[model samples]
Target chain A: MDAKVSTKPHEMLAATLSQEMAAVNALIRTRMASEHAPRIPEVTAHLVEAGGKRLRPMLTLAAARLCGYQGEDHVKLAATVEFIHTATLLHDDVVDESGQRRGRPTANLLWDNKSSVLVGDYLFARSFQLMVETGSLRVLDILANAAATIAEGEVLQMTAASDLRTDESVYLQVVRGKTAALFSAATEVGGVIAGVPEAQVRALFEYGDALGIAFQIADDLLDYQGDAKATGKNVGDDFRERKLTLPVIKAVAQATDEERAFWVRTIEKGKQAEGDLEQALALMEKYGTLAATRADAHAWAEKARTALELLPNHEIRTMLSDLADYVVARLS
Target chain B: MDAKVSTKPHEMLAATLSQEMAAVNALIRTRMASEHAPRIPEVTAHLVEAGGKRLRPMLTLAAARLCGYQGEDHVKLAATVEFIHTATLLHDDVVDESGQRRGRPTANLLWDNKSSVLVGDYLFARSFQLMVETGSLRVLDILANAAATIAEGEVLQMTAASDLRTDESVYLQVVRGKTAALFSAATEVGGVIAGVPEAQVRALFEYGDALGIAFQIADDLLDYQGDAKATGKNVGDDFRERKLTLPVIKAVAQATDEERAFWVRTIEKGKQAEGDLEQALALMEKYGTLAATRADAHAWAEKARTALELLPNHEIRTMLSDLADYVVARLS
Candidate 1:
C-alpha cells in the first residue's frame, strides 16, 4: 500500500495527510477520556483505539490547514468529527446486526447491542461538547447539519434496503446523506472555523463530497470482487443480505424477463437457495455491473480532483487531489 | 382534573405543570421544522404531534423562571432539552423493541425501527445546534454532561436487565442516567443561561435531580398499582419482564430463604410462568417493598423541596414545591 502511494505524484500528498492524521489521532484520544464514568473511556477506547484510518478527522485537519488555519480549535473540531463518525459506526453495526468491522468483532458483538447504542450516545454527547468548546456557532451549525444529514441518510438506506425499485437517484441521496454529508461538513466546518472565503468553503465542501462519494462507491464496488482478507468483510455479504447496491442495481436495470424474475425472488423477496450466489455472480458478470460501478467511482474521483482546481496551488491541495485518486486506485 | 386542582394542592401542582408544558409544546413544534427536508417534518411531526405531556421541558422553564431568570433563551433551552428527550425516547423504543409510548404506537412501530433511530439522531443533532445558538458554554457543559450521564444510565440499565443481583447502587446509577441527569441538566442549564448566581444554579440542579429521582421512583411504584386508564401502561408489565425495579430490589432484600429461591428461579433463571405475577405481588406486599419504595420517593421529594430555599418565593416556586409533593402523592 505504501509502495503504491510512494510514487512521485502521490508521495507528497500521502505524507501531508499522514502528518495531519497523527495530530487528529492525538486529539481524539485526548477528548475521549471521561472523568465521570469508567465505561465511557472503555467503550469509546474500544472503537477509537481500534486502529482504523482516521480518514474523516484527517479531512477536517487537511481542510483547515489547506485554508491557512493557525488556531488549535481545528484539532478539537477534527476530533469531534471523528467521534461522530465512530459513534455512528458503533450504532450502525448493531442496527445492521453485523458481527465484524475492520476485521475485529464489532463493539455490539463483543459488548452487546445495548452497550453499542448507549456508548454510541455517549460519544455523540462527547462530540457535541468538544464542538461547543470551539465557541463558533457556524462551526456548530455545519456539524449539526452534517450529523442530521448523516442520520437522514442512514434512515433512507434502511428504507431502501430490500426494495428492488430503489434507483440510482435514491441510492445517491442515501450515499450523500450517510457518507458525503459528514465528509463535506468535516471539511466545510474547518474552512468555516478558519473564516475562509465563502467560495473556498464551497470548494472544500464540493471536494470532500465528491471524494466521499467516490470512496463509498469504491467500497461498494469492492464488496463484490475485492479480497475478503484485504477488505475485512466477507465476499457476497451484500448479495446475501439482498442489498440493492450499485452493482446489483445496475445489473437489475439491464436484466431480461427471466433474470428479472430471478432477482425478484432472490434479491427482493430474499428467497435465495444454495445455488443463488452463483446465479447472482453470473448476472453481475453478464451485465459488467462491477466494471460499470468502478467506472462511476473513477468519475466521482475525477470530479473531486476537478473541485481542487479552485484551491491555491499548495502542497496540501496537491495531496488532497492525490488522496481523491488513491481512494479509487485500490480497485485498479 | 381542573376542579381537583382548585380544591387540592397536589392537583394545583399538576395544573401548573400543564400550563407551563403548553409553552414547551409550542416551542418544540416550531423548532422541529426544517426547510430542506420534507421527510424531517413528516417524521418529526409523527412524534411531536403525538401529544406528550412535555414534563421535562416544563421543568426547565419553571426552574429558570423560579430562579428569577428574565431572559428569552430559556424558551429555546427548554425546547432543545425536550428535543433531546424525545430523540432518546425514539431511539430507546427501537433498542428495547418496545411497541408503545404514551399510550400510542411508537415511531419505530408505526414507521420502522430504522426511521426511529435515524430520526432520533436528527433530533439530537438539531438539539445541539439549538444549544450552540445560545452562546453559553456553561449551558453546553450542563447539557453535554447530561447527555453522557443519560447514555451511561442507559447502558447500566441494559447491563442490569434480567440480572437479579443488580443492587440499589446499580439501580440508582441507572435511574440517575436514564431519568435524573436530563431533568437536572434541563434545570441547571436554565439557570446557567439566565445568568443566575452559581449557588442558585447548583440549588436548581439539586432540585431537579431530587425531583427526577422521586418522579422515576413514583412511576416504578405506580407500575405495580397504577390505574391502567391513567398510566396507560398495563399492570404487572414490569413483573412479566422481570425488571429489577426498586420494589423488586427491596423485596428481594427482605425475602426469606424459600422466597429467595423462588425469586432466583423466576427472575434470575427466567422461569416466569402463569400466576407468577400474583406470587410476585404477594411477595412485594409481604415484604412491605411497595411501602418502602414510596418512602424513598417521599424522601427525595422532600429533598427537592429543600433545595428551593436558595430561590426567592414566588408562585412558580410554590408551584414547584407543590409539584414535588404531587409526584409522591401518586403513590397513595
Candidate 2:
C-alpha cells in the first residue's frame, strides 16, 4: 500500500479493531433486545443498522488499545458509548421533530414521537446496564457525569439556540454538553478501565473533548458550505430552524443595526423569506465568520493532537492523531 | 392518635421520616439545579413543588429506616428514586400528551414537549449521578434494570394498550414495568444500602412490587369509578383514550360477538362516542369484571402485607403494611 493512498482515520481504526468492533456490535445487539417489547429492537436496529460511522465507539477502542489494554471490558464500554449516542439521536429527533437522520427517515418520524421517546429511554437504560456490567465504579461515575452534562447541554441549547444574546461561550457550553461530554467520557472511561495513570486518563479525556468540539464545529460550518447530499443535511437548515451556531453568533456579534434587524427578523422572530438563507450567507461572508469558525475548528483539532503528546506513542495513537485532523479536514 | 379520622400511611411515613425526607427534599433541590441552564431548575421546581405525594421516595426511606439503616446514603438514594419518578412523569406527560398531573398543569403543557423531554433527560442523568455516588455496584445494577423495565413497559403499553389480545399476564408485565419496577427498585436499594441480608432485601422487593401492582390496579379501577375530585382524573378518561385496563380486558375476554364488535370499534378503532364509556362500564359490570379487578387489587395488597412478615417488626413496617391496604382502599 502506497503512503500517498489516503484513507480515513476512522476507517483505518475500524479495520484495525475489526474483531473488537465485532464484539461490540454483538453486545449491542444482544443487550438492545427486549424479550417482551419487540419494538425496542425494531427502533434500535433501524438506527444501529443505519450505518453510522460508529466514531465514538471506535474512539473508545482506539484509546484503550493505545494504552495497551488487553481486557474485554473495553468492548463493553465501547458498546455503552454507542448505545448512549444512539439514544441521544433518538431523543434529538423527537426534540427537534426532525424528519431525517443519517440520510433516512428519523425514528420519530417513521414511528411516532412516543416510540421515539420511549425507545430512546430504553436505550439510555440499556446503556446504564452495560456500564454497570463493567463493574468499574470510576467508569460509571465518568459516564454518569457525562450524561448529566449532555442533558444539561440539550436543555441549554433548547433555551438558547435562537436567543440573540447567545455568544460563543454559551455555544461552547452547549457543544460540550450535546457532543463533547460523551466523547470525553468515552475516551476517559477507556483509559480508566485500562488502569492507566490519572495523567494518561486526563490526556485521553482532553483528546476526546477537543476532538469532539472540532467535530461539531466542522459539522455546523458544513451546514452552510458542504454538499447537502454528502452531509445528510440541507444548506441553511440551521438558519431556517433559527439555530444560533458559532459562525452565526460571531457574525451577529459584529452586526450593525440593519444586520441586527435582519437576524432579529429571520432568526429571533423566525420570519424567513426566499432570500433569507442567501442574505445570511452574505452577512457571514462579509464578516468572514465562516472562515473564523473553520479556524476555531482547526485550533481545536490541533489541541486534540497536542493532548495526545503525553500518551504512549503507538500505532493507534498515530491513528487518533490523524482522526483529529480528519475531522477538520472535511473543511478543505 | 386519630387513625380513623384519617392520616394516610404515606403521610404517617412522611411525618416519621420528616427530617430525612426534608434532607431528601433539600438534596433534590440542590441536585436538580442546573448551573448553566436556568430553564432546568424552572421546569424541575414546577413539578418538584407541585406536591406529588413523593410516595416513591417515601418507600425508599421507609424501607431503609425499617431495616435500621444509620447511614446518609439512603437519603441520596431516596432523592434518586424521586428524580427517576419525576423524570418518568415528565416523559409520560409528553408521551401521553397529558395536560394535567396531580391536579396541576403538566410540565409538557406548561412548557413544551421539547422542554419536558430534555428536562426529563436531565433528571434521568441527575438520577444516574446520584446512584453512582452511592458507590455500590449492586444498587446501580438494580436501578439500571428497573429503568430498563420501566422504559420497556412504557413501550409495551404503547403497543398493547388498545389491542384486545393483550391478556392478563401482559398487563401484569406492563404493570411491573411502568409502576412496580421502580417501586421494587426503590425498596430493594434501600435494603441493599442498609447492608441488610439477602432475605430482607428480597422481602422488601416483594413488598414494593405487590404494593405497586395493587396501587396501579386500584388507580385503573378508579379511572372508571373513583370521584374526579379525589382521583384528579375524569371518569371514563381511560375509555376515552381507549386504554385496555384490567376491567376492560376482562370484559373483552367475556364479550359476545356483538360486544367484541363494540370493543373493536371503540377501543381498537378509537371511534368512541358519548355512550361508549357507559356501554363499556355496563359490560364490565354485567360480567362482574370490576368486582374481580377489585378482588385482584385486594389480593396484591394482601400479598404486600404478607411479604412484610419476613422482615423485622418496626413501626415503618406497620406503616408499609397499612400503605399497601391504603392503595387499594380507594376501591371501597
Model 1: how far is B150 from its true place, Å? 0.3
Q: TM-score, each model?
A: 0.83, 0.96
lDDT of each: 0.82, 0.93
Could you give candidate 1's per-residue lDDT for residues A88-156 as a string of tens digits?
Answer: 998788778878787678887887776777778878988888887887877877887788778767776
RMSD of each: 4.5, 2.3
Q: In model 1, which regions exceed 4 Å deviation?
A: A1-46, A68-71, A161-168, A223-240, A245-296, A309-313, B1-46, B64-72, B110-112, B161-169, B223-242, B247-292
**B-chain TM-scores per prediction:** 0.92, 0.97
Q: Please provide, for model 2 over A43-121, each residue's C-alpha lDDT reduced to its tens digit, 9 standing for 90 to 100.
A: 9999999998899899899889999999999999999999999989999999998888887899988889999999999
DockQ of 1: 0.44
TM-score of chain A of each: 0.92, 0.96
Share of true Cα-Cα contacts across chains kept by each model: 0.56, 0.92
Give the local distance difference test score of model 2. Answer: 0.93
Predicted structure 1: lDDT:
0.82
Poorest stretch of ten by lDDT in candidate 1 chain A: A5-14
Q: What would the per-residue lDDT of candidate 2 be over residues B51-98, giving only the tens digit for each residue?
A: 878999999999999999999999999999999999999999999999
For candidate 2, state the interface root-mean-square deviation in angstroms to 1 decimal. 0.6
lDDT of 1 by residue, B1-332 (tens): 33432745434544665655666677777777754344566778887788675777777877777767776778788889889998899878877888877768888787776667677887898788788778777787788888878877776677576687778887888889878999899888877877778899899999999999999999989999999988877888887787889999998888889999988988887788889889999999998889899999999999999999898788878878887888898788
